[model samples]
Target: METTALSQDEVLSLIVSQLAAYGFSQLAQTVAEVTGAMVELAPSSRLSELLYLGKEQDESEELEPTEFPTEEDQDEPMEGSTDSYSKYLDFDIETKPIPRPFPDYTQLYYTQHKGPCRCAAFSADGKYAATGSHDTSLKVLDVAKMKNRSGDAGDKPVIRTLYDHVATVNDLSFHPNGLVLASCSDDQSIKLFDLSKPGVKRAFRYLQDTHIVRSICFHPSGDFILAGTDDNSVRIYDVKTFQCYTTPPTTADLHRGGITQVRYSSTGALFATSSADGSVKVWDGVSGKCVRSIENAHAGAPVSSVRVSRNGKYVLSAGRDSFIKLWDVGSGRELVRYEGAMHSRESLQAAFTHNEDFVLMGDENSYTVLCWDTRTGALVKKIQGMLLFIIQLRW
Candidate 1:
């Protein structure tokens, strides 16, 4: 028969008590909406009480949620999603599942060589993988049988031995045509080997005066080779003419600090360089002008590797700070900063998957190679091995 009006404090207390019973997560959603509405109605009143209540509730409910999809569920399509092409909305596409317990890498295979391997490359056809180790030997593994879409462990790859380098081989690149293999080393030279040739004796070596070649890459057209060295410059070599053109970066008065890695853009018109000076530099492959420089890009650590997305729109850099930075290549602005243990150490090398949907990074710890979803920054797959380096096979 009687109605009593509750004071503002009483109303707030009752709301908070109910939210506490429902749990902090649900309370958070409710409070967010209520706060938004409250701001619109009365901007002066501070939601301090509600904010404190939410904080206390969150502290009490500290355990993380367990409603995660199983590995099997990850492979299946959503139930209500239509099979028609038009039903494929932007958010409807299934995301790669996150790894459980993270990925533990162990040595899958290792061979005793003369020195430490500085680089590795997979054949363009995906039939073989070559490693240039510190042992001064080039080892090729027959990955033909190991080429499974699921990446599950199977038969071990057959190993072929090629001993040539007197010093650590720092870089290895396979030509796009699949017939020639190129390698650079601390010995200050780049060697081209013809797989069609019979043995180690049949391989032809190209000697360069540049010492400590840190990185080497083959152009998309396979007509030229790009090599980055400790000399603080990048050299472009014409494979046929055996002539080399050097790009000396004088804009910043230095080539960052010993160009650690170099890559040719997918379009072949541009290239990216990652240096120990904590910078990522983009240069015109033809004119050699430093178009964009992201200085202090990865502060407190060296920029170990840089990769351009297959679409040439995104540039991803991994650094010693254990951070992977995603940048808009066109505007030269950072888009995302992913900081986690998976990327939390020196990511010595990185490669983009065939679809450019994921990036695989090789870390110094355990020689672990991890795959990250380019869009979501989620861990996709991990390959275990003591890697000298990891590279995606490009066909």
Candidate 2:
């Protein structure tokens, strides 16, 4: 931590610097309240971070080959708030010593998919990219070969496309070993792709009657896969036996709503789910027992997405009500609320940056992604020009 004397201007500068460089709005606000010095998002801290940053890739190592470049330079900085709507920002400008030795940013784009991609994932080794799309198809790409992931041509060749589903594939996850890809669809099927093979093909497919497989996740140990269906129950499937447990995670007598999303903790010790009722449940990852449940979590608004933090300490949920709330994993109580970007009536996605400094989310109506300071709920940036109605973003 960079410490400074309370009387110096560096106090204010330090507070604002970390807030922009990181997402420590709590520190910025605390210092601002103590000193009465207005703080704001620093202009110089973000341009390089946003336009240049990516998972560092070696020339030899590959995350499944793609046409995308590892880095790029931006002619201008990303657009931030200037209108009256941006009331949380510090309106007045102040000078502070610029931080030296900014990190270089490289950008990559992958655009071979035929339609709007509803879901996507990178292989555990970062070697391949898989997408579930509106065309009711799934495409797997070689990220290493493309060099750059972005492509304007929708017809760009992919390893293969799987087309067995009749409806949109809502979510997809990779086995821990990256040997297989699992997907769940609104068409009422849970399918697994054998990535260990050179070509794309289904290794297993489980058909369901009335329930749509809305979401699915793999255990960190690669033992089993968890599926959440529209029928309001969670099912576990054994990878070896290819059989789904006859029992649901909760009692069959419980009247739960359709599960909108599911995520496992970093250790795979616990997993959590969000339902159509905006409620949430935490279950033991191994035993598949519902240990904690939050009812009416967002006051009846359907949860669009749910994620456990990279540190496994916090759980975040994005809702149809147009807000993202952070929760204490232990207490199950809401801690912070992030808002101000458009997500109303859409299943916009939310997740933490790799380092967990900021909370990132996308808006369907705005066609942009917004960054919020995680420690305190402050809109840091509104980013555009990279994606369209981004429903999928992963590190």
lDDT of each: 0.64, 0.67
Please count the clashing residue pairs in each candidate, in the order shown.
11, 33
- List runs of model 1 lying over 4 Å from the truth: 1-116, 145-159, 248-250, 342-347, 363-367, 379-395
- TM per candidate comes to 0.65, 0.68
Query: What is the total number of backbone clashes in candidate 2?
Result: 33
* Candidate 2 local lDDT, 193-283, one digit each (tens): 7766665465455545468887888876676777778767777777777777633444632327888888877556567888887787776
Best-performing candidate as measured by lDDT: 2
Candidate 2 regions with alpha-carbon error over 4 angstroms: 1-107, 146-157, 200-209, 246-255
Among all windows of 10 consecutive residues in model 2, the one with the lowest summed lDDT is 83-92
Give Cα distance to truth, residue 357, candidate 1, Å: 2.7
Taking the tens digit of each residue's C-alpha lDDT, what string does model 1 give over 1-395?
A: 57677566555544544333222335534664764423121111123334544674575477454589543233333455333112111222434332223233344454455555556788777778887777777877777544433445545564456766677777788898877888888888888887766565335758575568878889877878888887677788888898888776575735646888888865455788888788888876656677788888878578878887643556888887877878887688876665443444433666655445456676555555666765567766767654444432232
